[model samples]
Structure formats: structure tokens, C-alpha cells
Target chain A: MRKIYFLFASLLAGNFLFSQATPPPADDNSLSMANTQGLLRTQLTLTPSWMMKGTSGNDSTSISSARTNVYLHGTLEYYWTEHFSTRGDIYYFLNKNSAPGGLKKNHSLQVGCSYHFMKGMSLDPYVGVCGGISLVQISPMDFMKGDSTFLPNYQVPSHLDPVWAPRVGMNFYGQHVFHFFVEAQYLMGTYRPAIGPILSINEIRISAGLGFNFVILHKEATVRPAI
Target chain B: MPYSYYFSKLIDPNPMKKILVFAFLLVGISAFAQDRKPNKNVGGQFSLGVRSTISLFSDAGSSMGTGAGGQFRIRLYNFMNTEWFGDYLMSSIGTIGTRTDYHIGWSVMFYSPKQKPFKKYHPKPYFLTGHCFDYTRIAGNNPFYQDPNHSVASRWSSAVQAGLGFHIPFCERVDLSLSAQYMFHLGKDITAVTRTAVNGDEFLYIDKEEASINGHLLISFSLNIRCADLWHDHQKKGGARKAAPDPDGQNPKHIEQ
Candidate 1:
């Protein structure tokens, strides 16, 4: 056990040092303009957004409950030119609830698409729809009492089914550097049980947070010759 | 030569061996009681302990069993308490010969700082109540298997336990304790069921209830280290020694005199 712990510690230290070391610069002129356009135009504008959400839902018992859900929403917006752009949104949701006797944690991955109403606006409003599968985990204690039994509980079989949802939100860009916005999304799906009746599951979430966009490449200025 | 033969016969006699064993038992009990002095300043007070029974007893002899499960508690008051707990058990039968089982579960407990004592060992009894979502899988060649089609039951059940415990100070801020608890399954029948072979071709279902009493027994040992102390300084304000006696006999004479 001691040797294993030391080995893990050394591996973690090596990873940390490796991540901190800078990489050598590559040759600039060998890079093609098309590759540069693909990298700077699409990759640079693509920003990853993270948001914390709170959700309330009803179980099979029809009891009202609340859960703290944290999700990472990453959006990649591509512009064929400046005016025509398409945005692809991917979201990952993790929900955790600490109940009286046990706890339940669920993880879901979703991908969707959206079309912005006005192009190049600091505050861009968009409407989109998403669908993906969710993995639901339920932990229940047997003969114990109170919250102490919540931890050592068993994990039930995962629920695998495509979950479809629609989202609407506006991204508010402030000072061209920071963008903060809130969005509401609803998930509707049914838990296909391996045995027994099929149960319906629904979740609604509202989230808002800020993010920064880094300029990896700046457009060069054009100078006209004196005619 | 004759003395050696007689001595060997006396030492090897079977009836005499039984008598010697009885005599040893009599002496051991008496010696144990004499040494059993009530612990004094070894204050075993203010403790919470929990235990999960790995084995369960049912009323029916059919031997359809469930895994042992439970929780523990030591609460000085309504708001301040420490808890330790365990997960629900899954039952299974072994391949070779013996009855074996498995339980996959988790537990966590926390204590607020209000209920503990400042200087003395305080033992407080607490009540435990919680729900256990059990995924019990039972497999055995026993004749009393409950359901062949569905060997596992996924259901949510609740439990309650009441018990007394004591804490012995291990360090200035650490204490350990041992406690006994009576745990009861509030709802559902605690019975094991199995299928019996009938006429070599047909199978008949048999439900066995073993120890179907409302509750079962549990014993637990726990260690507690003080996280935060509120009144340690207040107790120190008074000298460690007992207060000096008053001259008046109105006060206890041992101190007053």
C-alpha cells in the first residue's frame, strides 16, 4: 500500500510538471491560409460555457423534490462568412440530491444546434433544440435510519434512452470581453425499465454564468497604395 | 513400576476429565466477577454507534434469506448529534456448500457541535430512522426460493433503531465507545421463501419465515474525535480540583470540615 501510494504521488507530480512546461514554437510560413482560417475562424470563435443549475422534479411517487445540477455547455459557432453562421451546442448535465436515507446522482450528455437571430450582436438571442441519452443512478439504503445510510447505498441499473429537450436563451456580451447569459431547458423522457412498468421522467433547468473569449489570431490590416 | 501405572490410569480417566472441566468453570466465573469492577473516571458517555446485521433470521425454515442492514446514532439533543450508518444487504447462496451473501451499500454521518459535554463523559441515547432502497438478489438450491422468475427485489424500505451507548475518553479530544442496539424493520415481512421439488417433475413454492419477530439485535463500536469544542475554556476557568469546602455544616461535612 505504501509503495502504491508513493507511485501515484510521483505520477501526479510528473503530470503536473509536464503540463507546466511550454512547447517550442512551430514554423509560421509552412502553415496554409485555409488551415489558418479553419483554426482561427471556427476554433477561436467556439467558446465553452459552464453553468450551475437548480432543478425540481417529481419522482414515480409524485413527490416534489429539488436537486442541485451543474452542467457544462459548449457551443461552437461557425461563420461561412461574417453574416451566415451555424452554431452547434453540446451540454453535459450532472444532478445530485442528498435525501433523508440515500442519494441519487444522474449524468446526461446532449448535443444540439441553433440559429442566431441577429449576426455579430453583443447580445445574441438564439433558439435551439437538443436530444441525447441520460444515465440515471438511484441509491437506496436497506435497514438503516437517517442520512448516514445515504452514502453506502447500492447503485441501481442505469437507465439508457434518448432524452429530447428544447432550450431558449440569449448570450449577453459585455465590453466585448465577458459574456453572461441565462437559459432555460426542459427534458422529457421515459425510463424504460428492464422489468416492470415504464416510468416517465421530466426535468426543467435554468442556468446563467459568465465566460471570456480569447483572441488567438487578429486580422491583419490592409494598406492601399497611393494611386 | 506399580506407582507409575496407577498414576497414569488416574490421569487418563475419562469421567475424571469431565469433573475437572466442571471444576475449572466454577473457578473461572468466580474469578471473573471479582475482577469485574465498575469503571470509574473511565467516563464512557456521549457516544453513537451503528451496526448492520450481516445475517438475518426469518420465521419460515425455507431458507430464502435477505442480507443484514442497519444504522447508528448518538444524539445529546435534538439538534446536536453524531451518526454512523451502513447499506442494505443483497443475499446469495454459495456454490460449494455454505450459505453466502453480498451487500453493496454506502454510509456517511456527521455531528453538530452543540450536544456534547464540556469536561465529563456524557452518554446519550439516540433514535435512528431512515429509508433503505434494497436490491436484494437471492440464489440458492434451497427448496424455499421466493420467485424464480425474479430473484431480485428492487424496493424502498424504512428502518428504526433504538440503543444506549457510552464513550470512554481516549485523549483530551478523542473518545471511543461500544453500544448495543435493537433494530426493527418498520414495514414489509422479514421472511425467506424457496421452491421445493414436488414429485420430481413439479415444483411447489414454500415461504419460510425465520425469526419473524419485529426486530433484531445489533452491537457496534465507534470512535469519535472532537471537531469543535465550545465550553472547554469555561470548565478550565474553575480549578481542576473540587471547590474548597464551606465552614458551615449546611454544606456537606466532608468538604465543610
Candidate 2:
């Protein structure tokens, strides 16, 4: 406990020192020009991603084939100045899968800044990092009670932990109205120990999705003409 | 033997009244001594306290038994007296929604007091009786569609308890004690919210009472003040008169002596 406290204290001190030493970048001269031209249009997006998770580590002790889990991912983004924008993503996984031992559900909320490299193109590539919390539930019934004909179920503990995932993905807009995209994220760090008999398994995956954007109010086609 | 005969008669079938009488006698004696002397030296003392405890256990899946709770105490009464006490407790367990469990209960105690002025160490037994309110939350997910009815009363209830405590004093005012107790539920029937099961063949309800044993381990610290100081001045005056011997070195035995 003392060691954990000391480590946390040092990390906080380091953050303070780095933040104090760094200074904001000089303002971009082109920002004003872009704002006046009206070329800097803001875009709002909602992406629903499909995720597939796997259990590694002590897998043999549990079921033979890990079940496939399905969850939805939502994202909202604002275009700041052309290629640079910020995005916030929310993940909701509700009762995705339940076995004899316990149930596993995932709910995450993250806000981060994203940088878009391409402009005016159908394809936009972006990279971002987000931090949030993950709630996992592991029921003992999953492992304690199972049929002899079937494989033994492995159960884990119920826990809430901090989650940080860095992601790199692309957004493809085909035909201007329909859009499809895919991203691979590495779910890292276990704030607490894994529950149940499986103590070694930690990292998981959040993968792939498709979405669409509807322009509710577009910029005027042209300024009104005089008589 | 005669003292025990009289003490037993004082407590026979009327413990509360006996205690009241004991308190009154002590106060009257202190007042009488104060009228004779005005100044005397009195020492200070301390006590140690503890409580017996009980807990009701529950899970998202199963229906268990009623749980228990209690407290224990080892206290120094004065320079010469020490006490030990214990209590028994009981509580009800209920589940909220599909993930949380709540518990509530109360307790009663019994104690004994021991006095040993000449010895360096003393053993005291004490008892206490009172009530308490307890709450607990257990978080998890319910996948089996079991106990679909998630209501407050269906999730929690309260119980009552009674028990014994043993205590020993080590210093002027400090002591150590341990206790064991049992808690019984006043309400035996379980209350729960009911909902239709996924199977459609049956309904599920979450019970307010858990089926399990409630037990606990506790450590306590306490302070005790001896009332001997109330008569210190009287003792001092009596001591002075003794120094001035009468013709035959005989003196009337007063209450202060």
C-alpha cells in the first residue's frame, strides 16, 4: 500500500513538472483566414462499431470455445480548423454474453482529441487516445455449476477498473452520404487483478464498425442575390 | 458467604432494580464522606471498549438465511473495578435490482464487573444490551434471470441480537476483551419483489432475508473514571486524626475510615 501511494505521488509530481515546463504553441496565422472564407465547416458524426473480445491466459480451464460478444460504439466529432478536429467516443456493451459461471458486460465513456490528415477526400485517417473506466462482472455460478457432458465453465470476479486504449483508424465516405470504417484498439492495463480462476488473462480487443452522416443544415449554396 | 447471600437476594429476579439500588448507595456514601472532609487526593483511571459483530451474506443467485451482528467491551471502572461486556445482533438481507444487496439489524448486551484493589492485575466481566442499525451493499450482475423482482423491501430488512462479552484490564484504564453472540430474526417470513422469468413457466422473487450465519471479530479501546476521588478529602482528615492519638489510642470508626 505504501509503495502504491509513493508511486502515485511521484507520477502526479512528474505531470506537474512537465506541464509547468511546456508552453502553448504560437497561434496559427491561417486560422483567421479560414474562418473568414467559411471553408472551415464543422462536421458531426455517429459511428456504431462492432467489437469481438477473446479470453486468453487460463483458457483451457474454462469453456472450449470462447463466445463471441457484440457491443455498440458511438462517436461524436467537431471539425476545429479543417484537418484538425476533436472527437469523443462512447462504448456500451450490455449483457453481451453470459455463461454458466458469470456474465460479462462493458460500458466505457471516453473523450479525446483526434487529428485528421486528409481533407476534401472520401477517406479520412485519424489517430487518438482515450482513458475511462470499465465495469466487469464475473459470476460464480458460471464455474460452480455445469453439466458433466459440457466443458467446465471458468468464472471471474466482478470488478471496476480504469481503462486506457489508444486507437488508429480510418473513415471512408463513399458516395458522400454512406460511410464505412474500421479501427483496431489495444485494451491495456488492469487496475485490479482478474477475477475467478483465471488470474493471468488481461488485455482484450475492440474492433470494426460502420456509420453514416446526414447533413441537417448545410451552408447556403450562395449569398442571396439583389434585385 | 454472608455478603454473597445478601448480594444474591438483591439481584433475585430483579436485576434492573438491583442496579439502581447499587448506584444510589454509592452516591449516598460519597455524599456522607464529603460532609466530613474538604480536601483529599484521588487518582484517575481509564477503560477499553469493544463490540461483537455479525454480517448477513448474499449473492445475486441464491436465497440464504438471516444474518447476525454484535459488539464486545473490556473497560476499567476505577482503581479497583474492571468490566467485560458482549452483545448479540441480528439483521435482514435484501437485493436491489439485479446487482446490489442491503442488510440491517440491532443487538442486546450483558456484562460483569470485577474489583481487586490489592492485586497488580484484575479480571472483570461485563454485559451490555442495546440496539444498532447496519447496512451493506454487494455489487454484481444477475444473468440467470433469477429474482427479477428488484424492490427495496425485497432487497433488505432488519434483525435483533443478544450476546456475552469477556474483558480483562492490563493498565490503570486500558483493557482487552472478546465476545461471542447469536442474533435471532423477529420476522421469519421473507419479503421480495416478483417478476416473470424468461422461461415463462415461473415467476422469480428476490427475498429480503438471507439464509446464513452472521459472525464478526472486533477490537476496542475505552476510558474509565473511578469515583473514589469523591471521598478523598474525608480519608485525609481521618488520617490526620489518627496521627493525634487519643488517650487510649482508640477512635470511633467513621464512614471515611
Candidate 3:
């Protein structure tokens, strides 16, 4: 757990340092030409998420939204020449026990597309859908086979789930190299177990993060578009 | 609270709530995308984004499930682009089990952009068709109260889906899209049930039966960003051109530098 905290601290420090050192871009989102494709953005984000449960499948309840967990997400994307563009994402969710065994940890891989609808001079609103798999580890399910006590250990083993997240949010860039964004996402976990009563895990995550938006072009092409 | 206490509650009895949220977001995005005139500047761009989905019905139990997926798209022309996508969804069956499904496919997205120069938000409607591989599995805990079942089954099927959708430009490089489609699957089916046998040993019974064909309704909402702009500046500055060139074209001396 200490190692995890150290890792998160290091990442946060790195992001802050990078932002401080790099000069803000002149052709930010708002300043760029309205219709043409702008900078292709490589975004690195960190969020503290609230993980919660929806309802009961049996008598059991999973993680509640009250628990704040750490989430790290990275998105690689292209500037849109068309109406939409594809995106690939990988997310690491800090320890939040939604499954039995002990504390639970998750690694997720997802792919989807983003549609830019409401473009703003500073703030742009959009929505999208992402689907993928979450590889998870939970506490061991066995209590005491024939130990000191005769209680049953209800935790289940680690496994993978088919999951999806639908998100709606906005991107804010005021002609700066670093951008700000906040979005709401619904995460649904589909893991079926063949033992005691268990409920499905669903959660809502609202994230706020910083982004580095740049482009790949030739030297002559680096000239900022006319404002 | 103890992890065990809350962990068992992970299975949601009200699965529709999640489904409802997903649907609502899709509608909301489409409406937002279409509200204004689109920028209408289709260029050479590649993008990466995340997609979220909800399965309307599972053939086994007719239950809705939640899933996540990804897509990689390349612009082929002003009116055409190709996308490769893959996703997985998990559904709940009563209190004991879940069904897992996987889909991987590619589609040709044909676009129609109105030739309005100064539209606020552009509306680009598209049509798509693609083939995918589908796999599903069913698992439950002990078949009996104190007994165990030894059988578990899973199947992989080939599938295809065709649908119509709209891409609403949210920003210069961001797009929100909603698509509705039908999927057809060819494979075997896996099922698990509680059963008692011989001397009354209660065990879980899992079996694979021939599934002639299967199909379902699929809806997807996505947020995608184009990638070309990321390397634009570095490339324009002759970042790569500054490096020593390879004489034979097979190897570059800059790699050693």
C-alpha cells in the first residue's frame, strides 16, 4: 500500500513539473480554426474516484460510492478531420474492494470513440461509449476449512469481467498547453460466480484531470493559425 | 464496512438502472452533437477513444448487461473511414451467476457531410457493416447447499452486425456518436442449473448444447479523438529530417546516434 501511494505521488509530481516547465501553446483549442482539425492530444489524467454499489443481487452489497479510490487514465487520440475519431484507453483503479477475498484491485483495457458536439472557444462538451475487460483480484473466498472457528468465509477468488463505461463531459483549453476537464462515467461490471449469493457491481465515476494537447506536423506547418 | 460484507452486495438486483443511464447518455450525446452546425472540415486524422455499451438481451436469460469496448479508426476519404472495434459485457442471472460476452469486428463508416461552410455544429450521418467473433460463458457457485457441481461450459461464435448511426462533432477533433444495430451469432450455448442425481447428491450441472443461431440488439455511445495533430509540430519542424539519413534506406545512422 505504501508503494502504491508512492507511485501515485510520483505521477502527480511529474505531471505538475511538466506543466510548469512547458510554455502554454499559442494555438489552444479555442484559438485554433473552428472547422479544421486541431492538435492531436495525448492526455494523461489522474482522478480520485468515489466507488459505489447499485443494488442487491442477493443479500450481499458491494463497494459503496462513499469510498474514494485513485484512478489513473491515459488517452491517445487524433485531431478530428471528420465528425468523430477513435480512442484507446488504459486505466488503473486503485484498491477498492468490490469483490470478496480481501481488498480488490482492478486493471482495465478499453476502446471507443468521442464525438465533439458543442465546441466552445474555451469549453467543449461531448459524450462517448467505451467497452472492454477488467482484470480483477479479490480476497480469498475460503474462511476456515477446519480451523479454530467454524465460520464460513464468503469472499470469492480473483477473475475478469466484461465491462463498459458511458461517459459525458467537457474539455476546457484556453490556449494553454495544459487543459482541464471533468466528466461523469458509469462503470458496469459483469462477473458471474458459481457460489454463494453475489450481486453485480456498477459504479459512477466523476473525474477531473489535466491534459497535454499537441500535434504532429512538419516545421513549416508549425505556424499558428491566424486568429 | 468490511470488504466481505459489501463485496457480496456487488451483484445489482436492479440491472436496469445501469442500462437506463447508458441509454440516457447516448440520447443526450446525440442531441448535444446535433444541436449546432458542424465545422465540416474532414481531413486526414487517426483517433483513439473509449466506448461504453449495454446489451439489451442475453439469449440465455434475456437479461441486460454492461460492457466496455475500444475502436481504432482511419480516415480513408472525405466520405469514407474504416473502424476496428472490440468489447465485452457481463450480465447477471438471478443471485448466483453472470454471463460474459466478447465482440471484435470492423466496419466501414460511410459519411454524409452537408456542404455548409459556417455551420455551428455539423451533422454527419453514417452507415456501417462489420463481422465479429462472439464468446460467452456461464458460471455459478456450488450446485447444492453443501455439494459442488463439476461442469462449466463456454462457447465462441462468429457474428455480424450492420447498423446506422450519426456522428455529431463536439469540437475540432472530438465526436459523439450513437449507433443501433442487430447482431447474429452462430455457435453453441452454455448453461448451468442446480440438479440432484443418483443417491441425491446436489451438484451444479453445466452443459454445452448446440445453438443453431442467436441474435441481439446492440447500442453504443463513443467519444473519439483524432491523433495526427499530436505529432504535427514535431514533424513540421523537421524533427526526423534533422537526423542523419540511411544511405541504403534499410537502416538509419541516427538510430546509433
Candidate 4:
């Protein structure tokens, strides 16, 4: 896991360095990614996520053995400047896990901004943080006869907990109507229920797919008097 | 009814040919029919927008709620604007109850400094005040309130909100805005009660309380686009009209009047 993370970080760093040296391609009539002001990007795809480095569950299976969670991730981002953009993300709970005390529902909605590093190139890289709310619920543990279930059999109800995520990603803008992107986010949240033990809902989520972009407004051009 | 029309129709092989010709004629008529330009009048710039809202600090729920809605703006002046909007929000009260709210409202906004049309890069701050009619419903599925009599409650109320916000124009046609407002509703309130039994069982009951007022904070972020210029520019209504450009965006030949 550490090596994977290190490799991803190295790739991002290398892209950042390369983007600074690269310039927008000349003689291109298609939409220029370098002039990103007033561009809106919308994307929707299924993202597979896993619980990593969080509090343990009450079930027999350890946290590491829990089933992966799948979510429908939707993103809407708009560039306010060449190097700054605002983003809103929505993660809808899609699949349920069969593991004991697994996630019944895990959904979140967040809004934040990112700062683009290679603002003048088609390979756009950035880092950002977002804060939002997550609605999380864990499945009820099994009840066995002649078993002392009173201790861990607390009523684990759904909770709306505050969540913050720090993410890193890159967008490859190779066309006017669509682009490709891959992002990874480490979400931090704690589900403190009214009647159960505190469970950390921290997870690392990754998603990559095509997204569509719309140019809402074009920059004004200088006009010369007609002679 | 014309002789040429009948002659062409008689020679056409398929009726679809006349239909296609009519469609092309309609397109040409629609293309050259509009002579209106962007209005320079006060409150002439019209915009349509969508927003996401977070409802906070309400007695009905313990956690903040999220909702989405849309709005439209009509500029009243260089420094004033009006917004019409509607929203639907849902919130959960722990494990006991769920609450849903519907709001339809209108607000007037006044820019701190007179704003120029299509300005970019800087934040345009404004103050706003509005009134809205809201409907709220709260229901519980717990055992204590499972009976049809006491399981659900709903109410209708009118509210007024006032707040300040700012807009950042990313371009000439689009702007992103953030605002925070406190809305106080004037009517009955739907209250939720949680009771714990001796065996650590929790039950929730929902009921309509006496006529009273309640308030909550609403934070919203929205993106708006200038869709149309509704009114004619008073400064240019009788003056020389700007020369129309060709279809390819080139200036046409200027003909002497």
C-alpha cells in the first residue's frame, strides 16, 4: 500500500514538473485546456472504495476483511480562473455488503476548490481539500443463542457525520467536448452514534473516467476598425 | 393557394418533400425574426440558476440537512436584483424521525457598490431580504409512534429571511455565488420527542405543537447564467441600430440610410 501511494505521488510530482515546462499547443482550433477560465466539467461514474486505517467493527471479520464499498460518484467542477476551480462532489450509496457488521449505507456530498499546478498544459494536476457530511450506517451484528451479545449488541443506527477529504488528481484535456481524469481521495470521518461505540468511517476512494466540459463564455477579442 | 405552390406540389414525388421545404422556411423565418439586442435598461439582464443548500440549527433535526433547488434573477437596477426560487430539503433526526421541508420564496438583492454588466474576476457583494412559504413534514417509524394517530405530523408556514452574500463572475455570462441567511418561520411547529424505556429501548413520537415560530440558518451556493435581456435599452431604442453581422460573424456591408 505504501509503495502504491509512493508511486502515485511520484507520478503527480513528475507531471507537475513536466507541465510547467510545457506550453499550450499552437495552431489548435479545438478548445484549449490552458485557457480554462469559464469551463464547466461534469462527470458521473461508479467508484469502488475501501475502508482503510479506521476503527474496527464489532463483527467477527476484521476491518481489513470487510467487503469493498461501491458508490456512484458524480462531480461538477467549474474553472473560475486559469489556475483555480471550484468543485462539488456527490457519492451515492449503491451496493450493500453481506459481511457481518458491514456498511449498510455510506454516502457523502462535498464542495471545495482546487489549485491547478500546470495551468498552461493539457495535463492538469492539482491538490485540494473538501468538507461535507456523510450519512453512514453499519449492518447489525448477528445474535446467537446462549451468547453474551449485550456488550457489542448496541443499537447501531444511521448517523450523519461531518467528513473532510484531501485529494490529489490529474485531468487530461485532449478534446473540446470531453476529457479523462483519475483521482484519489482519503476521506476522514467518525460515526459517533447515540447508543454505540465510535466508528471511524475513513476510507480511500479512487475513480477514473471520461468527463464532459462546456465552455460557457469565450474571451473577448480585440476588434479593429473596418477600413 | 398560390399557382406556383400548387405547381411545385404537383411535381414533387413525395409529400415529405413539401414538409421538409416548410421546415426549412420556418427555420429561416425564426432565424431572421428577432431584432432585439441585449437590454441596457435597469433590471433588464435575466438569469436562470441552480443551487445547493445546507439547512442548519433547526429544532426538528440534530444534524445539518442538504437539499437542492433552482432560482432565476431579474436585475432591477445597476445595484439591485430580485430572485425567485424554490427548494426541497430532507433531514434525519438521529434514528427516530425524518423531516422534509419545501420552500418557495422570492428575494430582492442590493449590491453594495453599483455593479457593471459582465464584470469578471472580482467579488460582487450584496445584501438580500426575502419571504417564502414553507411546508414541513416529520414522521417517525419507531414502535412508540407506529400507530396511525401519532406517527406523523406536518405544517405550513410563512418565513422571512435576510442575509448577505457575494458573487464571482467567471465570465461574461456565468457567475458563482455563495450566501448565508437566517429564516424565521411563523406558524405551527412539528416537534419530535424521544423516550427511552427501562430496557434501553428508544421510541420516537412526532406531533404538531402549538402555534409558534421557529428559525434556521440556510447556506447556499449557486451558479447562474445570464440567459436573456428582457427589456429594450432605453438609450438605443430610437437611435441607429448596430449593423448586423453575417452568419460567419463578419461585419456586413454598411448601406447608407
Clashing pairs in 4: B43-B75
Candidate 1 chain B, run of 10 with poorest lDDT: B90-99
| Candidate 3 per-residue C-alpha lDDT over B134-182 given as tens digits, one digit per residue, 9 for 90 to 100 | 8786665443334233355578899888889877665555666778778
Off by over 4 Å in 2: A1-67, A142-157, A174-178, A191-210, A214-227, B1-257
Better of 2 and 4 by lDDT: 4
lDDT of 3 at B211: 74
**Clash count of each predicted structure:** 36, 50, 103, 1
Against the native complex, each candidate's DockQ, computed on alpha carbons, is 0.01, 0.01, 0.24, 0.05
lDDT of candidates 1 onward, in order: 0.39, 0.39, 0.62, 0.71
TM-score of 4: 0.61
Docking class of 2: incorrect
DockQ of 2: 0.01
Q: How many residue pairs of model 3 clash at the backbone?
A: 103
For model 4, what is the error of residue A38's alpha carbon versus the real structure, in angstroms, after optimal superposition?
Answer: 7.2
Q: How should the candidates be ordered by DockQ, best one leading?
A: 3, 4, 2, 1
Cα lDDT of model 4 by residue, B142-240, tens digit:
433355656678889999999999987765666778999999999997777877656665556667778888999999877777778776445435354
- If the candidates were sorted by their lDDT against the true structure, best first, what order would they fall in? 4, 3, 1, 2
Cα lDDT tens digits, model 1, A1-227, are 35545655886897699689544325332222211111111211222222223221122421113434455555554332222223444545434445522224345555444445664445567775555555654444332223344224434455454455677877654432345666777765443323222334466666566644332433221111112
